[model samples]
Target: MWWKTARTRLDLGQRGMIMGILNTTPDSFSDGGSHAGVEAAVAHARQMIADGAAIIDIGGESTRPGAGEVAVAEEIARTAPVIAALRAEWAGAISIDTMKASVAAAALEAGADIVNDVSGLTADPDMERVCVESGCGVAVMHMQGDPRTMQVAPDYEDVVAEVRRFFEERLLSLVAAGIDAEAICFDPGIGFGKTVEHNLALLRALANLNVGGRPLLLGVSRKSFIGRVLGSTDLADRSWPTVAITAWAREAGAMIHRVHEVRPNTQALRMTEAILQGGNSAFSG
Candidate 1:
């Protein structure tokens, strides 16, 4: 499958491509303030790219549960410069993670290729127009509610079905609004509003999502749900678990993985790809 972005098309079949997450925010739940400046952010992006990430996803605002929103101008200030610097040296895909149209527009102007709207473009009415005008790839995600209250007693009759319905609606609406169907990818929003069970249910049902051939993007990197499931609070301990999930997701037919530590996850996906592609040639050696 191909994901068409603002400047180019990406081959999704290339070994479960990793979209490295570069959070340029001081309040993100994980890795906050680590790459808050342009230089630091650029350095990290370079490291991730060299580590085998096919795409770099930069986000300015903290979207952690109960996280407050950042202003459009402030968000752009945090992300646009970093995006510009990366674009200068990198020709690979760059994703701007923001919910506001103004922030997305500025990042696209500064050379971002995809808009990773955590709100799924439902928070900002102008977002649809901006995406249509820019022709950038979009990672439309599912969330039960806004970030501030998403996790407050989050409920789903059937988390997998509800998410699939959300994707179905978004695919039709976005295509009807002029986005090329190939330019859209569906993210189940793993930790957005899910309990441990809900998250697990979606992961197990990855191949069952009925999105009409669109790519499925999974971002479980360093998320709190992993900690909750593994009974570990240290963010450092979640790497292997995240990597394990990466391999599992890939085998389950996910095409894109959004991750914080790109190297290990990259290795996991690459190895998983190799094993899964083994033909029916019986082992003779």
Candidate 2:
């Protein structure tokens, strides 16, 4: 399968892609405020590209549980410069991770190639138009509710089936609104509003969420669910589980893995792909 972005086409059938996370906000759950300035953000993006990241996902607002909304202007001020610089510096795909159309528009003008909306294009009515107008790639995620209230009493009778149905409905809506089906991707929105059990169920059944034959993007790197499951709050302790899931999800046919630590996860994904591709007897254990 191929995902067509504004600037590049990703052939997902070949191998899994790593999307390095660049949180421009000061409050993202992990690695926030580390690349607050444009120079620092661009430098980090360069390094991630060298580290084998296929895409750079830049977000200016913190969507962590209980995080408040950022003003549109503030969000634009934070992300646009970084995206602009990276667009000029790097040739890989650059995605603007925002829920607001205004911010998305600014980023696109400044040189972003895709829109990764956490709201699934439902938060701002204008976001869809921005994407359609620019002909950029989109990742519509399944979030139970807004960041402030998503984790509060989150419930799902059948989480996997429910998310699959959501993807089906959104695909139709987006296509009808002029977005190409091939330009769209699906994300299960892990930890967005899920309990640990819900997240685990979705992870285990991730292959079932591949609706309309579009590619699936999994973003479980260092998420709170990993912490809760491992009984640890330190973010550093979750990398092993994160890499393990990266391999498992890739084996399950996920096309993209959004991660904070790019190098190790990239190496792990390469190894997993090699194993799944079947090896010579000499390389077998």
Candidate 3:
């Protein structure tokens, strides 16, 4: 798959990019309200960049299961300032994590490079138009349903196949709407409205998703699935599992990783890439 460059084309071969999550909500499932304020969020973004994050994903609303929706004005208020501050402070890519077109457009204007829409640009009717007009990178993700009721009892005939189909259809829609294919990326939406088995299946079959040759993003950082597998509900105790998932994703050809813990994930991906390139495979093993 190929990604667009400002002046040239870029290849994602065996390279893995890290996208640091900056939740600006006061009630996110994990680490909410910690970075809700603009100063705290900017500081965290700077730290993530220092720890080797290729992109900073700033989310205004909490999408955790059963979470309430934030007003559009409030969402804009929560995310725009952080995006603007990070754009001035950090040199790496900044992504606005919202499904609202107005919020995305405002963020791009405030200096965001990408739109990380968790709803796959289907939540808001004008999302596609905003993305197309801004010419920014777009990460289209697959979610079975809205966050409020998604995890109640999510089911799929075939998890991987359904995700692949979702990506294809979303890509086609975006392309038809005048967005360049290179500006697109596919995300499987790891914990959003999915069971542990479904999440595992999607991760195992991640490379099968063909979104018109766009990059693939995998986000499974300290999620509930790790807790479910390890028999722990504590988010803080899932760090090791998060690192393991990062390594697994690296070996599976994931172009980008959305992670909570940036440094460890970065180190794991770097070492995994070295091993895959035929360098010190024994040590990695």
lDDT per model, in order?
A: 0.90, 0.91, 0.85
Clashes of each: 0, 0, 0
Error of 1 at 227 (Å): 1.2
Candidate 2 regions exceeding 4 Å error are 279-285
lDDT of 2: 0.91
C-alpha lDDT (0 to 100) for residue 67 of candidate 1: 89
Question: TM-score for all predictions?
Answer: 0.96, 0.97, 0.94
- TM-score sort, best first: 2, 1, 3
Best candidate according to lDDT: 2
Show model 1 residue runs off by greater than 4 Å.
Answer: 279-285
lDDT per residue as tens, model 3, 1-285: 666522234467657788999999999888989997889899998888888888889999988889998998999999999988877766678888998899998888888888899899999999988988878888899998999999999999999999999988888888999888898899999989899999999888877875577788888887888898988878788998888888888787787999998988888988888888976422221
Residue 71 deviation, candidate 1, in Å? 1.1
Residue 84 lDDT (model 2)? 89
Distance from true location, Cα of 66 in model 3, Å: 0.7
* Sort order, lDDT high to low: 2, 1, 3
Over 220-240, each residue of candidate 2 has an lDDT whose tens digit, in order, gives 989988988889999888998
